[model samples]
Target: MSTTTDTAPTAVAAPPVPPRGGVTIDEWHPEDEAFWESVGRPVARRNLIWSIFSEHLGFSVWLLWSVSAAMLPRIGFDFTVSQLFVLVAIPNLVGSLIRLPYTFAVPRFGGRNWTVISASLLLVPTLLFAWAVQTPGTPYWAFCLIAATAGLGGGNFASSMANINFFYPLRKKGTALGLNAAGGNIGVAFIQFFLPIIVGGAGVFGLVQAKDELNLERAGYLYAGLAIVGAFAAWLFMNNLSGAKSSPREQLAVVRYHHTWVMSFLYIGTFGSFIGYSAAMPLLIKINFWNQPVPEVPGIGINFAYYAFLGALVGSIARPFGGWLADKYGGARVTFWTFVAMIVGTLAVIVTLRQLTPVPPSEVPADPSTFVYSEATRAAVEANSTIFPWFLAAFLFVFAATGIGNGSTYRMIPLILQRQAEHTTTPETRRADMARATKESSAVIGIAGAVGAIGGFLIPLTFGSPWVTDPVEAVKMAFGVFAGFYVVCLATTWFFYTRRVTVAGRAPALATADV
Candidate 1:
């Protein structure tokens, strides 16, 4: 009965006017433990909604450069293709590396406080971007610095997932976390989709442009605006749900689990696919599809690319759905199939690119690309392009499957840890303590999460191929390699618990659903 659209923000519980005895006052209230357990579902659900919304905004702002980087020439920035990719890659790189530290921040400081800190940091990069863009004389170093600031937004994902993990029962952590993550990821697609509209429809920087200055100020200001709104929302409605602290030593202790490493690799497969394809969407479209371009300022390239939005959109929407599917079936069941599907999707792309790409020394886009047609290509043949559908399908399957894996893996982790913990404990104590599983599960969550989030950066870099002769052949080889990697991962799942464990979340197997 409850859906995001069905939940009314105004109907949610109101934060108290004044602070009460160290209570976290935000969108959520963890003031009463009993109340949180009994009446907290609606409240947490509402919080999840807002949390996703704010986190979503964070992703959008973080990815602003990825969208804008595509339009750099229109903005008067003379960036090379490689340089542009690197610029887009910067946020992902820093964000990936910082995930561990960000995961830890919640335990050190309250989640409420960290949310504000992380959310507020977004302004620095965004405004810096705006500032750098305004100064026509600004150097490349300045742009790079501003772009790097966007990395701040990327850290929000790890912390957000970490905080939310403290809020749920192990049984529901998958769905709850899935909702949170999917909601946040929607930001990536949204920004990519809307930035073009904003620029194309309203002359994107229209609000910030002065006759004498470059109008790119809106790019940063737009991010600043989203950051401001998220901060205000956090201050208004977010709650600090604390507990689940293991000392730094305790957290480092979770790294000992082999499960952590296995899942990390799987993450590089699923979430990596989501992040990699998302970043690659526009370039895929621009190089492959016909677009209408407009002349902006003489020195800059400013036209919007229309076809790229679909890839990110499909990827974003599929994530939560995948999580739901995993809940119904098993994480490994869905994940294995999903991984298999990703390979298929990539193959489709490889085929499409080879077919669409122009031949060497042929009339194609002015610059060389990853795919070039071997035979003379016709406009009618180009009209029938497979790149769009294949790329879109690849992302859709990847995002959804990643989400499913997220849930199932989340479910499996606590269960796996519980079984392992019980093996070390005496029967009477294990029977007496039902809560042990919940506690241990919570402890390992941040570790797995921090590891998994790295996929966001790794997948993109994985897809970032070396320069190639036949753009088409090179891309084929690259995707073929990626697809092959997925196959190995699927094998790992089968070898591990999934093969013999016969768990409930596994195919037809029923293990206790503690996770």
Candidate 2:
């Protein structure tokens, strides 16, 4: 019997496999410390890097009109100040409207699939821009239609944020999201800084000579090429997580939460302000501080293209720092203080605006190359130049506050939903509830992003209101309204999350949740 005995082989466990490109990951456990250390971190980092690159290009395409609108006159497009402002505002309006659907597309399709689709969509706007600028007979309505296509780029932020949200644990969400957002936000600065040089309007810090004539179509061609590269990168490097799947009805259910709407309102004060101010900054500077072909001097006034990029640069850099502060202190705490700073900055800007005399619409020449400035117009330009430093400093301070608020407000969303889930779950069901909460948080982020973007449309339109006879007065009125809105935002933040309040025996206070 011993000689004839047969032996059976023992089973051996296999090592975990790393995530592969363009593949669907069926298992993901980012919240697990051991799993995160070994696999989740690397996978998350890889997706985030490509997400940022795609989103950065998206943002640049979205704001192509921001820089382009200011240069239209030099390129022989005769449009009024109000009309130029409309060109910039149209993209924001379309972008905001498309964001809700863009958000849901991530979970419906897959993060990787949607990213490739979105990145490819950017070519539509860039190509349209190229065609519109190059065609001599393009009508104003046709230009508006082309600008509306740029909104395709704006929707990218919503989907990218929602996608990245699913890849990180609660502890790292603040930093991860902030870095991703800052990377995209910096695109505003990138286009503002480089487009003028590309279009032959200005040089690199005035050190390099610009082309003899403006060529706005060059900007379109360059960004179009970059958009193709972004699509290829996403297709090659990104992956879809099976765990992120959700139905549109389930995602839309997040809107029922009171906190969702509250966050949307607060985001309007932060992100809305950032995008809106970015679009309006160049035109504001052009109208207030500089006049092309100054009276006797051919080119002797403050060039807006030279300094317009600085505000976005400072704001983009500050966003990550704000997220770090929120992680250490608390998101609500950081957001509240940011609003206080915004109010003060807006008031400072108003003071600077009041110091300079407004340039009458009648005085602004339709043909800059063939016009001369009157005594009054020349003095107004001189006064504007003197007050320019104070104005720029104030606006920069405001942009910094908006950037900080943007980071902190977003950090608060995931924490708030997580707390809600904890209060509603028992020990047996905690994991399932927590997973649902993550999905809700992502949905809420998309909603807030969409609502906040509406502010971008409102801002430039307010500055160049067709109904308002005086653009300067309209701008001053707009700042006053903005300051009032920030006061409401400050109070709302305190009332909801910062203050100690009980909610139907769910939890002691939201503040205790570290939101």
Candidate 3:
């Protein structure tokens, strides 16, 4: 808790909260130990909890189509693997674009008010998804349009992060933000994990079907109900803080900072990779690891959809640890190494892809009466079995690296802003300078988040359709391209932040004082 003395009256009872509608706290001094201990802590915690709930629902809604797309075959949708990739990829494209406007909405409408509205907005996509999926003959254009609406969930992350930034003291902000983000990130994993079970095969608890069946529309209905809960909870419990308010000019000031753009470019490698890889993994597994049953204890021929959640689960869980590491080490140093790990991990995947032998073309009848099987054809299935575990491990490493990079890159932003503040401001104006720096950092974080999410759309497109003529070769090519991008990120981090440069007469750090 903060230890500063407060001139305001010591609360004789609990602090007063707004009585009607959503609560609004007009006075917030989280930096003042007395105010924080007395009034800020509880209010902040309450807002954070509801924010997590709302954001969590948003992520699940945003990625809902990914799981559903994998089930399209069973549903008789009749889309090619390429068409399905486009179906899943459309949401990511829409979601990335939605984040920018969503970021601005927090300040324009008040965080609590916007959270209620944004959470409620998720209903559109969910309902459309359900309605579209219920009819197998739903036109591809209609499905694409419906999928785009899911991007509403993606927008929630930016606004939610920007809002929470205002609720905590500087010392606690990193940890609080890390927890909030991790809570949302895990929702992707949870959707993937529960989707197969919810759509049900073997009727684990008799809540669903007993035989293998695809109830694709169930995914949409599940999240739509959760969206309602999120909106209601935000309306009933969350608070809007007056201190967190910002004008367009102040928020836009971040655009003038050169580091903002640089960090955004790097973020494309971390967050972009994380979200992109996540959206693509279900399809990748289904297409590449085709012959293996997902190891059901009581059943045979279980689909691989059950295990698709593991990549996202590990990635989301690793994110907080990444932030913590960045806090201990310098964010620049941690981020640089994260890029290194990502490069190595992706290369491993490419190598694994290379090990698989391609299926040969069918030979024409030798004597016009009989055909012969090529050796390559006979060995194709055996090669898949050989490469599955190795491929899984390589991709898991990629996921882990992206998760860590997401945390580290974000942790770096605030410190870089603080360094800039220290360099430009006088000692007498230091407090005000730091506040401005924090505000600008918040803006840049939103922008970087939106920019980074573009990776999600690009990755699936890069890999071509899941049914590409040679999926193994396509994956190899895609990983090679991704690895090259990481190398660029590593060099950028080292050059801008980790290396010391002389300003005036002395060497000053870009990430100064354990930053």
- Which one wins on lDDT? 2
lDDT of 2: 0.89
TM-score of each: 0.79, 0.93, 0.87
Summing lDDT over every window of 10 consecutive residues in candidate 3, give the lowest-scoring window: 292-301
lDDT for every model?
A: 0.63, 0.89, 0.79
lDDT of 1 by residue, 55-143 (tens): 88778877877767766665667865556666777777677677778777776776667777788888888888877766768777777
CA-only RMSD, every prediction = 9.5, 3.6, 6.7
* Cα error of candidate 3 at position 34, Å: 2.8
Kindly indicate the candidate among 1 and 3 with the higher TM-score: 3
In model 2, which regions exceed 4 Å deviation?
Answer: 1-17, 293-299, 358-376, 501-513
Candidate 2: give the clashing pairs: none
Q: Model 3, which residues run further than 4 Å from truth? A: 1-21, 201-210, 291-302, 359-379, 426-431, 465-468, 502-513
Q: What is the Cα-based TM-score of model 1?
A: 0.79
Count of residue pairs whose backbone atoms collide, per candidate: 25, 0, 1
Clashes by residue pair, model 3: 2-33
